[model samples]
Target chain A: MENVILRDVGLRDGLQLVKAIVPTEHKIEWCRRVVAAGVPEVEITSLVPAKIAPQFADAEEVVAATLSIPGYLPSALIPNARGAERGFALGIPKLNYVLSASEEHNLANIRRSTQASIDDFGRIVELRNETAPKTCLAAGIATAFGCTIQGEVPEARVYEIAAELCGLGADEIIVADTVGYANPAQVKRILTGVMKEIGDRPLLLHLHDTRGLGLANMAAALEVGVRAFDASIGGLGGCPFAPGASGNINLEDAAFLAEATGFATGIDIEALVALRQTVETWLPGERFAGQVAQSGLPKTFAPIHRQAA
Target chain B: MENVILRDVGLRDGLQLVKAIVPTEHKIEWCRRVVAAGVPEVEITSLVPAKIAPQFADAEEVVAATLSIPGYLPSALIPNARGAERGFALGIPKLNYVLSASEEHNLANIRRSTQASIDDFGRIVELRNETAPKTCLAAGIATAFGCTIQGEVPEARVYEIAAELCGLGADEIIVADTVGYANPAQVKRILTGVMKEIGDRPLLLHLHDTRGLGLANMAAALEVGVRAFDASIGGLGGCPFAPGASGNINLEDAAFLAEATGFATGIDIEALVALRQTVETWLPGERFAGQVAQSGLPKTFAPIHRQAA
Candidate 1:
């Protein structure tokens, strides 16, 4: 059975837009619970100024707590070279950098132009090499599908940005439908184009379920050979730029898709669903979305490895 | 842009499970509104006895009203030869017959064996030939993917049933995920196999959104040249046998998917959304599901025909 990597970004992307500042201990518990469910990787937090996103004020503390977990592969989001430096100084093994393909969304989201963010990415790569040589630098192009503000993001622009990121020595390339405006056909086309530019570098998809096409897009990505994806527990993480939209694809549902389609995710769906219940109790007023938790896994469900055996 | 036929089954399948008996006039209004939204065909009602499904007690009145609408192709579901005779007597242009691929589900749903249903279908075909030769006979195999009552229905069983129906003179074949257990890979495999048995006959997929894989399965079906699908307005419909599951795939979402993926659906999405609002007012207690109604269409959304123009 083929295996795919599902990275839970609940701590970083999921909590960023949240109003309530979860305690460092609770965030650590979240990391611990998701890891116990056999998630291969986790994005613990973003190394940004406390004032920008008060919810992630304890980023360093969260990172320290996650590093204490044995055999856990933890990553952090880095918006610029400064954030990269923070991650490097903390000895984080993976750092993800994101820039939007849509100009309006990039400026609105990070207060910089797309080209400026691209240039910053180059500097971050250099910083990673000089300071944390063992660190993996993953460059993610946000709004690779389309943008709520810009309306239409050209396929060529996404390919061009990906090629530039690759030239800047990125260890991996990630394409994100930050606003969830992607369809399966568009997902296949853009990922196919991005794959051509980035040869054999590991690729991941970060998709949102804004229009209920997230899993469908994931299926298309799988068909095109993308083996890694970013999902959030209970479908957490809404884009502040796209209003009236749901969050990222549900982690349990993504694992279910992987297994049901004959791929091994190594993640226990029942455990994730139980964790989601705990998460809902802790978060209080936040809106969560996922079907597997409500409907339960199908009776015939068996992991790909089990089916193979 | 290639064209696909979207048949709205809200009035028939969608209302069948509802305890509330929607007024006959309202059902007529639904037929008129959906046709105005450019839906080419609609399954307006089932020809079963009112004692069986009281929600469809006014089936004849609904069909009569729908047939009065200009250029609208209306179809009805018939469970037995008696139902088919009623449809023929009414001069209905199309009739749909459903049998389960799972023997257990067949007995539980229609209170008969799979072989008996097939035999009844054969008799219905002979009756249609004698009384209404121009009427199109669409034979649907429910639980074709997997079953809640009987898990893991074999692929060969589905192919065999489709072949038998074709030999029995079925005008079209429909593969249904009645319990919403289909994955995209299985959808592709089963539909590919069924297509080989029923060559050149029109095929439609009736899918449910129970597990959130409806559109993904639809995408896979489209990849394999399936152009017709069954959807419900506001995603109304549920399997009594599949507890805790959501309804059928949303009509607006399905049309949005077809248009977004470069297929021409000729559906006015905004109009369908408006009708969904009206539907909600009419059926206050029923739970409805759809994303396009909540998020609104993407800013860049243009139907395939308009994109080509």
Candidate 2:
């Protein structure tokens, strides 16, 4: 069993994309069900301004609720230093902070320049060190492959930023296809460069299925030795900053791909498939995407062995 | 530029699934448009019994029409030795012959036992040798990954058949995920074995998007160095013999993935994207699938350079 980590971001990334703000209670149930489905980690919410994105208004409550699910790690996307402080205060073991490789997208997404975002990441790292030394801070390099506004992002620029993030004490470096513009060649090339520059640091990938290359990119990342990936249950996501971007790679599908390809994701495909029904029922007409949901698992599919949580 | 071949199977595989018998003229137009869109090869139609599949009643006409398209090779599916005689008699350049790796699927599909299919394949090769030595014969092993009926196709089984096919002088040895049950790992593993066994034979991949792993499987195949592939326009196909089988991989999406992943497919993605509209209109209410059609080409896409064809 190859060791691969599939971190579910449905509660955070998926919910944010929905127009109808799901109640906090439903979010908790979604969290519980996904954790029970064998996902080891879940990005429950983003600590952004609730005023700007009302869908994630109950970020704190959602994180708190997910923490109660024992044996599963809970994470939150912290947009800036303020959000990092909030997440750290809430005792999140891991906090994902994002910066865009494209200057225009960085400005458009977080209302800051590229350097400003880097500075914020440094501050967030310092805050984590001071307040919660045990917290793992992952710096996600968004739009690392291509940007909707800026188009092709240079691979050199991504490596330079990844090196900086590594030097600034970021525990993990994540290459994000913010607009889903990455192809496998780009993924392999970028991850090869980013990994080379940030030697020995854990590298994760965040992908969107905007152009339907999400899982392909994930497979490329795996080929290049990336073991961690961010996926959303039912393929629910859309970046408000990056227009036309679809959902993150579907969690169940990602888990299925990983496990089927001989990587042990510790996920129960049948459980996830069963839970997907509940999710579809919960979010009617929400356009949940994934094939295993429609085609069901193959008879040859063997679910990962659970260690009895 | 990486040389990857995308063989369009929209005419043969896609239409065979359609209940309506597409007019011969429309089929001719589709063939012309797809060839103009820059596919190097097109599987024109299946030389099967019209009583069995009425949609391909115009098989001979379509093949004759497409042979006029300059700079692209034309192929047709030959189910048995008689079909091979028909194809070779029509002066087709290449003939694709399929044999199922799953014993159950082979029996169900062509109504022949595994040994009987192999014996038939030998006869087809003899016919090709006698009639048109210039015509290339490709042996496609369906259910190479998994089968709907048998499930979990052993890699050993695929390699054994591929080795036998190679011994029989197959110009190309192709692995087809007949039921789309392949994951990237399964693809890599099986292809690695099959390629090793069929050393130096032109190995191609035929994938279905049943589990949404079409592009992912393509990337995996690419990783393992498979250069030729079978694709259908608008992701159309439905295996009548296999109960849960879906369409072949989308041609435009396959081209997009191949080109995007740094392989020079020689496909004008813009043209293919545009032609997809005509296909949609031609088959109104048909469930055409592919992400590139919905999201358009990305800003980073660079169409492969065509050599004045």
Q: Candidate 1: where is the Cα deviation over 4 Å?
A: A306-309, B306-309
DockQ of every predicted complex: 0.66, 0.71
Instruction: Show the lowest summed lDDT stretch of 10 residues, model 1 chain B.
Output: B300-309
What CA RMSD would you report for each candidate?
A: 2.2, 2.2
Once superposed on the true structure, which residue ranges of model 2 sit more than 4 Å away at CA? A306-309, B197-199, B306-309
Q: Give the DockQ-based CAPRI class for model 1.
A: medium
> What C-alpha root-mean-square deviation, in Å, does candidate 1 show against the real structure?
2.2
Q: Give the Cα lDDT of each candidate.
A: 0.89, 0.86
Per-residue lDDT of candidate 2, residues A1-309 (tens digit): 568889988888888778678888888988888888778888989899999899888888888778878878888998988898898889899999999999999989888899899988888888788889999999999999989998988888899999999989999898899888899888888899998988898888999998888898898888889999999889999898888888989887898888877788888877887887887877888978888878888888886663443
Tens digits of per-residue lDDT, candidate 1, A1-309, equal 788889999998898677678888889999999999889899999998888888878888898888878756899998888899999999999999988999999998899999999999888887777878999999999989888999999999999999999999999999999988999999999999999999999999999988878899999999999999999998899777666656889898899989999999889899999999998988899978877887887777887652231
Give the alpha carbon lDDT tens digit for every residue of B162-207 in model 1: 9999999999999999988889999999999999999999999999
